[model samples]
Target: MSSDTYDFIVVGGGTAGLVVASRLSEDPRQRVLVLEAGADTNSDPRIKIPASWVSLQGTDMDWGFRTEPQPLLGGRSIGVSQGKILGGSSSINAQVFVPCNPAVIDHWNSSLGNSGWDWETFSPYYAKAYTTPPVDDSLAVKLGIDGWTGHSSAHGPLPTSFPGNPSHPIRKAWADTFRANGHYQTQDPFIDGAQGSFSCLATVDPVTKERTSAATAYYHPNRARKNLHVLTNATVERIRFDGEDQKRATGVVYNYNGEHREVTCSKEVILAAGALQSPKVLELSGVGNTKFLGKHGIEPVIDLPGVGENLFDHLVNTTSFGAVDDLETLDPLILDPSVGEQAAKDFAERQTGLLTSMGVYTYAYLPIMEHISGEGQKRLKKLLQDNPPAPGDGPDQIRAQAYYKIAERGLLDPKQASGAYLSFIGPWGGPPEPGSRTLTLCVMLSQPLSRGSVHIGSKDISAAPIVDPNYLSNPLDLDLFAEHMLYIETLARSAPLTDLLKHPIIHRDPASDLTDLETARKWVQKNSNSMWHLGGSCAMLPRQMNGVVDSTLKVYGTTNLRIVDSSAIPLMSTANLQATVFAFAERAADLIKEAWSQK
Candidate 1:
């Protein structure tokens, strides 16, 4: 086989891989090569346009993987759309840029046994990844960001700004409604963890009105560097490992242009193939559970059994209500072909109109106790106490105990947010009635107790992995999520926000009429879908705790193999995964540089 050599070989030229490769090539001496299984569609309009995010799904750019039939979700298979293009999911996500709770990052070290992974140590990297747009006084008031100060980052590769028209009334209405309910944010969520309602930033460039993704921010600008090479449509089959006792990744074997090729890396092989595929790559390289590998007639180089365990994702249920006719919403763009044509024309000429935003502006992160009834709170507490992690000493049991303890404390704390709610000014789940407008209220479980897995389905590298998120599998998850779902009705009926909506609210989906807790639970069981914020498949924890990687993100049984994507995130982020993934890649780059500087 024809072969090439480099200092570092990065698998999957997606979000994290591009960042690491770009950073490593800055030295002008280290040769770095990135292999991506999908084609480079960075210039495609569906990826660049802010409102065209939804249209990218099921296209060539999307992997279009679906979960195994979820029993709790009524035997329905939820579609998980992962990006199969240059920038990965960042190129196709809804672009809601938000942060994880500070406490969750702290838990990575204090409870999960990873040192130097706390909020203080990890927060700076968020600034290193993106530059927050300047918010003027008038715009701040309109966007409910008047009280925020010193939260904007002046220097970064990715540009973020508030999407949509500045005159949109829904923005102020959401702010005033939350303020009236005494749930307005006290501080900026980006600077410190706040549990109240506030406007969020989007990964869209204000000047260009285009989506600013990893390919646009990190790769395109640095592509001119001579030492950095990125090849799209290249699928890495497995890593080539050497060393008798200690397996060290030397390079990789990949398929390109229908031909098998080999490339040698002298320093390391970095795996950044995202949450679902990163673990598959490790397992394919003979690094997963020995018994599982034996089933496929493949020998295992490492006996580590946690390559695809502890999968985490945010499941969301959306409730849409009829909006007043006078209010402007995205419904016109969908229901009227003429309106969509005008919107496209406006975007082409002035970079304005319905095409500029995804219609998701306001967000609220709330504790379960804030919305549940007093009796419900008592039941939740009792339920938690009654089910204190299974009694055992095995690694799985110990991990479960640690996770449960943290979840229990956070669920009870008034300051910690357990659920996230957001507002969308348009129809969701189904098409709207002719000439009728709508607004969607989306509720998501921020910290779910239920865990799932993603594993190799067969020996072929082309086959999709078996992903089972086991949504609502934990009883506590259902109880807490139902309460949050019930709160949607209260939020929609609240004062200034209600003025935008019609009286006797007409739901887009009849099942979304959550009148009581029981109805809410039933709706959730039938309607909840993935937010696509997947992570923790190859978790970073101690080996005894079934951790696939260590604190430094190096594979547990390999010296030179490392993972630098959402897959290595020990916990799920509270909101969207884009911001956290960018920050993580920035930190991972520094970790790689620091490790090699010592050598």
Candidate 2:
């Protein structure tokens, strides 16, 4: 067996791993090797064009894993997609670029006991990762925070902006309605806070309007470097532990080209294989809970109880509409020339304008939107109205507790054995709103109390993890989701919105009983799916807390092991995970550089 050695060995040359490798190798002295268990980025179109990503699901480029039947979701197994390619999930996403709320950053910092984790310290990295483009200068007034963090108009490799047509008429109306309702329209909320309506930016080519993923930003730029070697189609089996100290991860054993190979990391081994795979790698290498390993007959090296604990994800349901005219509803505007000829032509010729827009652009927050409303509200109130209140608890409080448990473990129907609870939502808002084309009441619960696991399905690194996000395990979870739903419904069915939608309204494929509460519950059970943001598996925490890695991203038990991807996030952020993930990866690079400088 030929042994290859490097100063740093990075597993999974996706987003975070690539950033680490690129930044480390930039020193031109330290050697960095990235091992990817999937394909390179160039061949995947679903990754390049923002609109084409939907088709990429279940393909080889994606580790299409399904959950253990979720009782809350009608006993249905939800599909989870993670990129099995160089750029990772960033190569394939809706490209909605939003930042975490400052509160979220502060909470993370306080929990991790690291001052550097705060938004102020982490803000620069966001700037370093992308170049913000000029979009309707109208954003200055609409979006309050203009001068903070990476929200500046600084030019760089990654392009950021909204599509050229702010006149989309629908979006414009929606924005106007939000403003009239007193909701602040924010710009680059990551800079100020994710609390209002704002246009998100994507990492794309400034001239070409193409996505500038980790492959283009990191690998492609430095492919000529001799110190950096990337191996594709390499499925890592497990890490080779050093019995001498038991805390040293000396190298990795992997299956390459139908043969087993071992590669050594002299200084350190960083696992940027993401949240799901990282924990599985640790368990397979014998670094997890002793009891669980004993049950599986697998030896336990480190008794880290939190290896797969603290698992949570974002759940979202889509409410799409068919335009009254041939208004190109849910159509591919980037690829189809007829939709926006000038912008597409400009993108083809230059790389700017709407051609650069990620199809699903624009975001707003309904602050007043409560967790429940409409059909389910009356039903839940009636069902639990007579149920004796628990020890001084009010009706809302009692109901919340019940719904939380139901959502956390997943509701089960012993008869049909379908366990899940659904909350009712309303369509309250209507016409006169700038961007109000249709009403969509989204349900997202915060701080899920249910615990789940992720493990290696087989030796194939390309194979997806056995993921069970266990939605609606707690009864309170349902209530919180219901609160958000009802809030939106209120806006949809309110005076203005009601008047606009007075004509024939759109309805979801009904998934509930005839009663309002039953119908809402069934709808949620049948429709609730993941937003594809998976994290908290290889969580970042102090060593004593059973955390996988430290604040600096170094693994807890092993000196040579570090994690720099979304998996390292101890908790979920307020906004989408892309910008934050990219920022963290970039920050990890700086930390790595600083460490090498001291050495």
The digit string of per-residue lDDT tens for model 1 on 267-324 reads 9999999999998988898889999999988789888898899999999998999999
Indicate which candidate wins on lDDT: 1
State the weakest 10-residue window (summed lDDT) of model 1: 368-377
For candidate 1, report its TM-score.
0.98
Say which candidate scores most in TM-score.
Answer: 1
Per-residue lDDT tens digits for candidate 2, residues 1-599, read 13398888898888888888888888777888888988886545446655456667888888777788998878999887888888788777666666665555665676455557887788777778777776545654333233223456554445665543333433444455556665534445655666555445566554545667787777888889988888888977788767445488889888889999888878888888887888888777777777876765677777777777657787665332222332222333423457556654665676544445454444554332321335544544443344322453543343234334332222221111011111111121112122223334344543444445676655445566678777877554454444444344444544333443434544432231123434455555667677777887877765544566778887766666778888888666654678888888888878877776767
How do the predictions measure up, each by TM-score?
Answer: 0.98, 0.80
Please give the RMSD to the true structure for each candidate, in Å: 1.6, 8.0
**Worst 10 contiguous positions by lDDT, candidate 2:** 414-423
